[model samples]
Target: MFRSLCTTALLVPLLIVSTTASANPEVDRMFAEQDANRDGVIDQAQARAEATRVFRALDVNRDDERVIAELDPQIASGSPGGDGFPPDIHVVLRQATMQLRDVDGDGRITRAELQQAFVDGLLKADHDGDGKITRAKLIRMHQGVVSPAR
Candidate 1:
């Protein structure tokens, strides 16, 4: 009984510290940027803004449309970049994201299409259709609860 108590005491603090330290600062910064209003959630306006920003980044040639290559040059080339994701998972995710964004079968996603996708996706993630997405919703989306269909 004494040994069990001693072990639990040692492990409890370690577990608490691990949980507290597990948060990714980079992820927090990005999430904060998305939160905009700092309301602990992202609303439609913020989601649309993020979509526009992403479209601008993807439309490198400023063509107002995103080709497969523009989405991720490395993934399109079948040679993943140092984006930390395993090559297979990165390629699959990019493919799924492309499919979700590209409504037209023409193989390109236009700026408007991207924005619409964001709106639609946010609507789907909003569950209650309240026009707001909480961090829990975002976490669920990230965990593939909604999958690529989002």
Candidate 2:
């Protein structure tokens, strides 16, 4: 359960932090909303853009920061195909996401803090400390996790 929580906790925020801001609306549209290049890797620019977008969505009051009150509802809603977790998972998800993103323990999240969270998450996914989320590297990492060679 702990491992599941760790992986999904990281993945959920990563999913929420996906969008596009490039020219060629159709082409950008073709990619994952957060992956402007349709590649599995999310570089720093993409991470920042997506983090800013997600932060804006979470702010809800046009204020520059996110508080627990704003986050609770979104986590509780659990609408299918929306930004929510299962009812049973919301509490943990909220707690983990908050703990990671808050960065200051001041009970609020600024845009920069959220952006840094996203960038940091990308590094976690990188798995090789290359400062790059390359597809080949991720595949190798996944394979090692799935079936370690003797």
Best by TM-score: 2
| TM-score, cand. 2 vs. native | 0.62
lDDT of 2 by residue, 1-150 (tens): 222223332453444333432322322331254576766665778877877776766566888998766667555444345556765787786777789889999998899998888776555446555566554443333333211221
Clashes of each: 0, 3
Model 2 weakest lDDT span, ten residues long: 141-150
**Looking at candidate 2, what is the lDDT of residue 9?**
26
Q: What's the distance in Å from true for residue 111, model 1?
A: 1.3
| Local distance difference test scores for all models | 0.56, 0.58
lDDT of 1 at 76: 37
State how far residue 1 of model 2 sits from its true place (Å).
30
lDDT value for model 2:
0.58
Once superposed on the true structure, which residue ranges of model 1 sit more than 4 Å away at CA?
1-30, 74-94, 143-150
